[model samples]
Target: MNRIEFMTELAALLQDVPVEERREAMQYYNDYFDDAGDENEEQVISELGSPAKVAATIKADLGSQAGDYAEYSENGYTDSRFDQKEMPAGRAYQRKEEKEPPKTSRALKIVLIIAIILVGAPVLIPLGVGITLAVLGCVIALFCAFIALVVASVAVAIVGIVVFGVGIATLIPELAVGLALVGTGLILTVLGVIATVASVKLCLVVFPGICRGIVWICRRPFQGKAVA
Candidate 1:
């Protein structure tokens, strides 16, 4: 119904109620009617049902002591005699409106706590493997380097020993010094390979976890709200 029609029906219904409650209910509804436009008012009134139905419900709810003398239709509605009849207003009508929250809203929360152990373990555990592989590579490389140094040292030592043997047979000290230099170079080269392999493995293992975290963060907004 239009605003005017709705007001007319409300006025009719409130006639039997006490004055204060009647006015309050009427005023509240009037304010509501003004706040909403034609489309909304129509929708609200439609939901509330016809004028007679609305009036009847309000009268009953207000606790009007309707008796057998009260006019009702075959289906217990006010019949023709109730039309335009004025009853008292200005009584208390306890109107309590309860508005329920939307059923589909989701609460803000922490969903998953990614276990750091699960992620870091895979990256760290393989460091041992990488270290072993690098060490093996370095050992092989250093062993070859060491062998070259040793052979070169030995050849020089023998030549020195022969040269000294020609000069008085006293070049043993020079041979010993050359062999010691060859051994030291082998140890340092092995360490470098071990460090290199570990670095490669750490970089590779952590990459996939970072990528997964990025994708999950991006999709958070689009996730559907929980229906409760």
Candidate 2:
């Protein structure tokens, strides 16, 4: 359907909603359409789906907020911190209350935290230390393994060169023995080259990726603290 027809239907469906909320929702969609330009009018309408669907979502959100407000009022706390704003289609309206916790509640939380710390300090401290040590040990082990692989690869290449020289010296004495040594040296050298390439790739790509993953995991808990 076209924008005007769609909006008309949406308005009719939202008649039961509060006046201010309805107006805000309407204005938000109107502005959205203006911003999108006439070229994308059909695309926007398609993305919004049916007007009845949009109205139902808004009504459901309002119902949930009403329930929350009712519960808040029943608790003998009154807040005049209501806020309404226009949003995108799926979230056409938002109502938020920016109320701080009561002083008593905040004090209670602090007391509870202190109590927990006092009771659990012995176990928590050791547990945290053990976890940290385990992670460090794993990282060290991986690094040592990488170093060992690189060293082994280089050692094999060096040994192959020495064996190849010995084979050349032995060639004059025994052709069969010299040929066998030469073949063995070539195989070892090829294997060493392959291992070295693999180690280089691990160092340049895989190891850094693993480190980044660990860092991301460590930061996850602190990332959204402001929102909390």
lDDT of 2 by residue, 100-147 (tens): 876677788999999999999999999988997998899889889898
Candidate 2, which ten residues in sequence have the lowest lDDT sum?
75-84
Looking at candidate 1, what is the lDDT of residue 24? 59
| Worst window of 10 by summed lDDT in candidate 1 | 84-93
RMSD each, Å: 16.3, 18.7
lDDT of 1 by residue, 1-228 (tens): 577887797788678777865675566556544444444666556555566775665566546454532433332323222233242121123334468875652332222224555677798779957975776686567556545554555455455444434433222555565454444433333444444455445445554655576577656657744331
Q: Highest lDDT: which candidate?
A: 2
Which regions in candidate 1 have their CA more than 4 angstroms from the true location?
Answer: 64-228
TM-score of 2: 0.52
